[model samples]
Target: MTAVWRKSPQDFGDALNIRETVFVKEQGFANEFDETDKTCDHLILYDGEKAVGCARIFPDGEAGWHIGRVAVLPEYRGKGLGARLLCEAEKRVLELGGKMLCLSAQMQAEGFYKKLGYRTVSEPYLDEHCPHVRMEKIL
Candidate 1:
């Protein structure tokens, strides 16, 4: 039950693997990996030696930070790993002097983000063929 969060190059690979399994192969987001990852900071969550979840954060001009590509292995869902990854991402954003955080949450995940204090800022829209809504949280 010990989970660790950290920044590392390996996180990119681990995150991509999870995204591919959940978003691409399963959900069919053909272009899931985009240019944003090039300039953003990624956080990885490990349950013992297994990578269970990950999230990425980037500067959103001066408005604050933008979080993206958050995912957890299917078998790992409902265990709070996603929330833990988000908490770690928010901490990293705050460490960088950010005052707010935003994300385009998949419609199905809006409730989960809401529980984490994120408020919807827009109506649902299509993102990669899936319904998504913009959400934000003020730090």
Candidate 2:
């Protein structure tokens, strides 16, 4: 079975480990760690005792929240964990009185996000040396 939970301050190490493995070690993203992490809300997914997915949501300086740094360990892809993480993030946003949620999705994952009801709001662009597009969904 799998479970998702909001990470406590002390639980950050597990979340960071997953992100570092997926975003930096596997995907070659430079500066994968950022200052914003200290302020953003983080979610982590676990399959039994193993942490397999992670994502973060931060206030967008507006009425909605921005979701980013979503990552699922390589072995855990194709198992719907990404969708679970996103859904959990959206739930948190609504609980926090947010009206919508947005994310900068990598080009390759655009279809996946679309399948979850997110609509593209921007043209494709480069970020972290990869193609990305802005997408959003109303909660």
Which candidate number maximizes lDDT? Answer: 2
- How high is the lDDT of residue 99 in model 2? 92
Per candidate, the number of residue pairs that clash is 0, 0
* Candidate 2 C-alpha lDDT tens digits along 50-74: 8889899999957889999999999
Query: Where does candidate 2 have its weakest 10-residue lDDT segment?
Result: 1-10
List where candidate 2 sits over 4 angstroms from the true fold: 1-9
Cα lDDT of all candidates, in order?
A: 0.84, 0.88
lDDT tens per residue, model 1, 1-139: 4444445555467777778898888788889887776667877777787777878888997959999889898999989888988888888889999999999999999999999999999999998689999999999
lDDT of 1: 0.84
